[model samples]
Structure formats: structure tokens, C-alpha cells
Target: MQQTPSVLTDQLAVEIARLGIVGESSDIGTLHRVTELACQAVPGCAGATSIRWAIPSGDAGERPEPLASAASHPDLAEVADRQLARRRGPVFDVVEHRRAVSSDDILVETRWPEAVNDMLSRGVRCFSTTPHVRAPVLVTLTLYGVGARALARSQHAIASLLVAQGSAAMSNSLQYDSVHRTAVQLQEAVEARAIVDQAKGILMHALGCDADDAFAEMRRISQTRHVKLTALAQRIVGDQGLPEITERPDRTTD
Candidate 1:
């Protein structure tokens, strides 16, 4: 079947929007949506799998990990597992080359001997892959088919566009996660500082000492009791009420 580029683009946009909304609730769910979208968007795609490759750090090599996957058939998952074990299949090539790769008949493909043999045994015939490079992590979207000529030959253009849309969604998710983590850390710091300050004020009034002396007393107690200064301060402020002064002949309220 033939579909217009605009139609595919529109579908991609809608799918990305869906993933974005789902990401707000669950990141894993968003990735599952991505694999499902790939199966729907790619022509002749019977199954889909997403592989996440960690960018190599220094001299150590980073291995690719399977993040999420969805298959129209059980055999398709077998194909993915076989390729993963071989680590030299179309998906791996896509990651290495940073482009799309396919085998009309995976059983006859010689590029990946081990993987092809496994695919042949599992009755998997066709494979198509597009890479999404998002720095630090490279995501590979793979499609599988049982027919000899599954995906339309030379359809990398449309596949790339689809991959681009998914990549954008993934990028947005990564940014959102980073911002959320930073906000949590900042909030924790603010709360800790506030509690510490409140405890210091309480200690200063109770001990009739300056801020530095109050802090020192808390620190000593914290060490002696093997508790954090903030925790010790909270206990002191909670257990022993702040000193209240009343005007008297011998002592005036200070």
C-alpha cells in the first residue's frame, strides 16, 4: 500500500504527542507506545523493538540494551532475541552506521551469519532498522516481517522521518526527567536549610548564646549522640521549648 509523506508525518506527530502525554505518567509506558507506533507507522512492519545503546565512555565499550519491545507475533520476538545475542544484525549495523539497513530475506543475509541463521530457524524472513541518535544513548527501531519481501525496498526516507519524530519525543522526555530531578534536589536542600535555621534559633534562645555558640552546641550533641545536626536540632527544639523570659527584679527580659 502507498501512503503520502504528509499522511505519515501527521501520524508521526500524533503518536509523538501521545507518547509525550504518557511520559508524564510513566516513562516505560511512553517507550512501549513508541514501539507500538513504529509497528503502525512502518509499512509491512509486523513487529517492533527498541534497543538503547549507551555511548562508549573512554576506553570501555558500552553494550546495547533492550529498553522496550512489541511484536505482532511471537516469532518476531525470537528474531530480536537472536539478533541481540549475535550483536551483529541489521539493528546493530544501523547503530554503527547511523542509518537504516534491511534485509529483504533475512535467512539469506550474509552480513550477519549467526543472526541470520537464528532468524532462518525461527522462520523470520525480513528485517528493517532505523537509528535514533540522542547523544549518550542511541535508540534503534527495528521491524520484522515473515514474508520474503516484507518492507518495500528503499523506503529509508519515510523510516528516517518516523525515527526523527520518535527521537524528538525521547529528547523531550529526557529533558523533563532532568528538570524534575533538579527541582526535587533543590526543594530538599531548601527544606533542610529551613529546619536547621529554625533549630538554631530555638537553641540560641534556650541556651542564652549567640548563633555560633548555639550551632557548636548542637554539633557536639549530634556527634555524641551519633545523629545528624539537623536531627539533633529538631529534637532539641521539639523536646525543650524555647526559653521564655519574664520581667523580674533580679532579671530583666533580654
Candidate 2:
């Protein structure tokens, strides 16, 4: 049972490295995909991946969200998600509590009532979790098998490597997403300003007015037309081309 998955882990790493997430943003969806791969690498995994960080669960806030996962069974996945939301389960808490949780008999682990119940219902017998000590990063590596005692020592090592790479991938993805969003916003603003200026040019020529007067006129048209000044300017530059000052509408709603 364990022999095949250990080999698969090395093969999986080669495949995962080709994913090209280094020094880049890893989207939530990509993280989910990698987690699914981890589940697949292990023979007995029931196809579930959990990636969560330990946030300060205080007297006043809900726990963290399930950052990403791709589970084979939807119901079991929901149960795992809820456990994360509550901040009271083995996967996240083991890391939070700074302890290793290993159980051959999940039925007797009173500390994890909901997780144990969920595992039993899902036919998952042996569950083990190790705390990942990447500070301020609440990452835990989990390994479990259906109707079994514990993962082979080799399997545990394999799971650790998978989780480590997954963590790095997720971190890079977030950074890239932030940068991309900022760049898009900047581009949009620059484009909007360019349209406004072109509209201003058209107004100045058509109305035979100063730059300030042309802008005020554009704003007036925008308000009157119930459209953005940028849009009005774009229309002046693009479609109907800048219209006559006489084309400016009244700004009164009544």
C-alpha cells in the first residue's frame, strides 16, 4: 500500500516544480489543484486537501476560511470547511496548538469531536497531523488513511514535502495577484485621464474656449447627460466626436 505512494511523491514533485509558481502569485484555485495532487499521490487518501493558516482566534472573531481544497467527496469537504471556520479541528488546530496529533483510533480522540465524527462517517480511520513551524504561517501537514492505523513513516515524509511546496506556491500566487491588481488599476486611471484630456481638446476647438472653460463644459455635459465625465469625453473623442456647446444639456433633474 505504502510502497507505490512513496515513489509517486518524488514523481509528483518533479511535476509540481514545472507548475512555474516560483516568485509569482499563486491563485486560490491553483492552491486547490496542488492540494488535490497531494491527495492523489498518497494511495489511501480519500481525495481531500486542506490548506489553512492559523489566525488569532480571539474572543471576538470567526476562525479562518478554507483557503483552498479540491475534495473528491463534496459532503466531507463541507464538513472540513466548517471545521476550519470554527477553528476547532485537528488539521488547523494542531499547528495552532503546536503539537503533533496522531491517532490510530480517531474514535477515542475526545479533543476532536467534530473531526473525529466526520472522519468516522467518511470511513477515515487513522489520522495524523504535524505542525509546520513556519512562524506567523499557520500551516499544518495532515496524513490519514481509511480504515488504518497510521501512515507509513515514508508516507509522512512525502506529505511534508508536498505541503511545503504548496505553501510556497500559495504565497507567491497572492503576491502576484496583488501586483496585477495594482497595475490594472493604474492602467485604467491613465486611460480614463487620457480620454478626458482628448475630450477637453475637442471641446476647446468646438467651443473656441480656454482649457478650464472646456473642462467645465465637459463636466456640465456629463452631469446633464447623467453619464461620467470620462465617458462624455470618450464619446466626444470617439463616436459622435465632440459636439457643439449648443449640444450641452441642462443639469436640472426636475
Candidate 3:
């Protein structure tokens, strides 16, 4: 689950390592690199952006999961977001259904009539969403400022590999997030626990009980009152009164 790539995968590894892209913090760099590399490696792939559909992890159902975008280009991200909101673009559908999505002719997919028309209006006619091997993830390589006919002359394998690498990078990013968060939580827990131990020592001295008994007493009260251990420690240490709990803040983007 380490995001580090092997030496044999030297090509991509070299680029990622050069950018210092190890995890979610490196997402932007990863996106930019993917697009640049994809364009160079795959024919007719004017550019690519890392994009995800209907990310369950997104807060408030507002932002499009994570997309590998070249930049904070409003036109590109807006089109992608609109397609998802409209639920009518092949990119969204492919990512949502976890399938290889291609449109040799976007006009043929009747299900996305409204969305397709809108896309055509943007001067982008043909595109595809290739499923990343480490999926539930997808990459949509948009061939724009050019016609889909150009894609017909290109190598299919190269395109597939471009998407595959993008997927791997995305999955690795997620795994990095998991590990980073676990570490932060472990540190926080240890700190909170240290304080709790201090408070327990105070109680143990006051009540003449053993360490185990003191800890057990804290657990009993926390469980009975349905409060978290850290919160309890705060109250006992700072004498702060307990109040309502708010939505947990997302530390990923933060």
C-alpha cells in the first residue's frame, strides 16, 4: 500500500519521485504529471486529468470526488462536474459503474443526450474513460481541439496503459491517505492517552486504587455517558464542560 513504485516501473516512478508525490498532498502534482505524460505517451490525448465519479468520501455531496486535472481550469472541471450533476456523461457513468467507457462517437450514447449536446457545444467531441486496475477509479482522457477520427489512427495499447498508470497513481494516493491518517490518529490517541494516564494517576492517588482500576473507571464513565476518551480527558484536565459534537472535519484536503 506504500505509494512508492518499483524500480522496474522506472518510467512513472522517476516522474513521481521527481515531483515528491507520495500521497494526497501530491495529488495536484500527480494530476499535472499524468496529463503531461499522457499527452506525450498517448497519441491524440491532447491532455488528461485525474477524475473520479460520485466519490462517497466527498463531504456534503458537493465536490466531484477527486479529478486529475491539468490545472484549476474552470472550463474543464466545470464540464466534468456538470456531467456528473446531470448524470448524463459517459465519463461519470464509466467511473460510477467501474467500466471501460469509450465513445468513438459520443452522439451514439442516447442515454446522455443532454450532456453530450452540452459537451459538443464546448468543442470537445470524443473521449473515453478507461477503468484503472485498482478500480472504483477511472481516468477520462479528453481529446479536444481535434476530431475523434485522429484517435482511430492511434495505438490502443498506449492509451490503455496511460489510463492504467493513472489509476495506479490514484489508488496509491488513497492508500497514502489511509496510512497518513492512521499515523496522525495514533499520535493523537497516544497524546490523549498520556494525559488520561496523568489524570488517572491523580485519581489513583486520591482514591488509593491501582492503575488498572483507574483506567477501568474512566472507560466505565465514558461508555455510560457515550463520550470519547479524548473528550473526557479534556474535561478532567481543563475543566471544560462537554457540548454538542459537530461533523468531523475532513483532514485529507485540509
Candidate 4:
């Protein structure tokens, strides 16, 4: 028995949601999977390509930068690249306007003649670009068809649903990356501070001065030698020496 349209859509949604969970680890992986799934799920879709763009904050008018892209076929990838290279075609328009664009017959499409010719040469007769915005990121999913009017409006919901799931997954992945980076930086900072403190203790013992005086002396030496405080501290700890400071100068009151 053939499956009903509702059953097919439900299954597609479930598959896309599963990708969301599995793809949380990688934004690019989500995009690649979405393109592959689009070809399999969307009716009349011969091939698919997706572009992920980073929208700059506080510049609503600024053009978004392309972050990543994936395509199901080489020809489809080439078609999308040519559009980006020329800054024209349905992808560009859809991104700029934040709306969907479609061409039923590229052979006679007037908006982007050159792009149409390129697609025709690559055996793409029709295409649709749909934008999915997920704040700080905008993804455009383009579906390619081999016949005129092959892409029907009836299947647009399926494509949109796929892009939405992909966008959510990408957002979650980016957040995870950012948090991981911040955590690493914080760990490095803590390690650096600990080393610096150890170096100060060594200085206090060698110079017979207080912590503040030792730190001040270390800073002075660091400035004169053009070496980072952390590097100087590490050297002091390793060598167990005065770091070339021969005499213990009078502590200044400040």
C-alpha cells in the first residue's frame, strides 16, 4: 500500500528532527545532511544545495557573509557558486529580501539570464530558494529540478520544514562551540594566574620583600626585557634565580 501524503510528511519531519539531535555537534554536518535529505524527501527535487550565512549584528542593511555550503551534486554546487560569484540569481535575491524565490523555467527566466544559462547548461531547468532565519544565522536551501515546472508549490512546505530543522541544529552547534571556546580560555587564564603567583612567591623569598614589592619588581623586569610576565614568571620558577637583578633596591611607597 502506498503511503498517504500526511504520513510521508510526518516521516520526513521525524527524520529531520533526528538530524537535529545528531547534528548538534556540527553545524556543517547539519547542512550537508539537510541537502541530501531534501533530494530524497522533497517532491520533484532532482538535487539540492544549501548556503549558511552569518548576519552581522547591528547592521541590518549589511550583506550577510556566507559561512558554509553543501550540495547533493557537483553540478548543483557549481550553480550555487556561480550565483555567489556573480552576486545574482535566486539565492542572492532570497538572501537579500529574506523571501523565497523560484523559477519554473530557467530557459526563459528574465531576472538572471546568465545564471539561467548556467543552470541550463548544467541540466537544471527549474529551481527554488527558501530562506530560514535563526538569529545571527540565515540559511538558504535551494532545490533544483531537471524539468520545467518540476518544483511545485505543494512540496514547498517540505523544503521549508527541512531548512527550519537544519537551522535550529546549526544554531545549537554554534552555541556549543562558543561555550567550549570560552571554557578553554578561562582554564588558560586560571593556569596563567597560578603560575604568576608561584613566580611571585619565589621572588618574595629571594628578594626578602613583600608580595606587592616582588610583583612590582617582576613587572619592572618584564617591561625592561620586553618579555611577558607569565614567561618571566615561568623562568623564575624554573631557574630559582634572581632573573639578573643583582641588588635588592629600596621599596618605593606608592
TM-score leader: 4
Model 2 ranges off by over 4 Å: 1-5, 8-10, 19-48, 51-61, 72-87, 95-100, 104-110, 117-123, 130-141, 146-149, 152-157, 239-244, 247-254
Q: Output the TM-score of candidate 2.
A: 0.68
> Model 1, poorest ten-residue lDDT window?
245-254
Sort by TM-score, top down from the best: 4, 1, 2, 3
lDDT of 3 by residue, 104-126 (tens): 66656566777677656665556
Q: For model 2, where is the 10-residue window of minimal lDDT?
A: 1-10
lDDT of 4: 0.83
Candidate with maximal lDDT: 4
Against the hidden reference, what TM-scores do the models get? 0.77, 0.68, 0.56, 0.82
Candidate 3: misplaced stretches above 4 Å?
A: 1-21, 24-29, 47-50, 54-81, 104-116, 119-122, 133-139, 191-254
- What is the Cα-based lDDT of residue 160 in candidate 2? 65
lDDT of 3: 0.56
- Residue 28, candidate 3: alpha-carbon lDDT: 54
Candidate 2 per-residue C-alpha lDDT over 1-254 given as tens digits, one digit per residue, 9 for 90 to 100: 12224247566767666434655334445446555665667665654545656455464354444445544456557656767777777776665466767777776777788878877876677766654433334445565576566465556665666666666666555556688999999999999999888878777777676687788888766787788887787788886855446743333432
Error of 2 at 124 (Å): 3.8
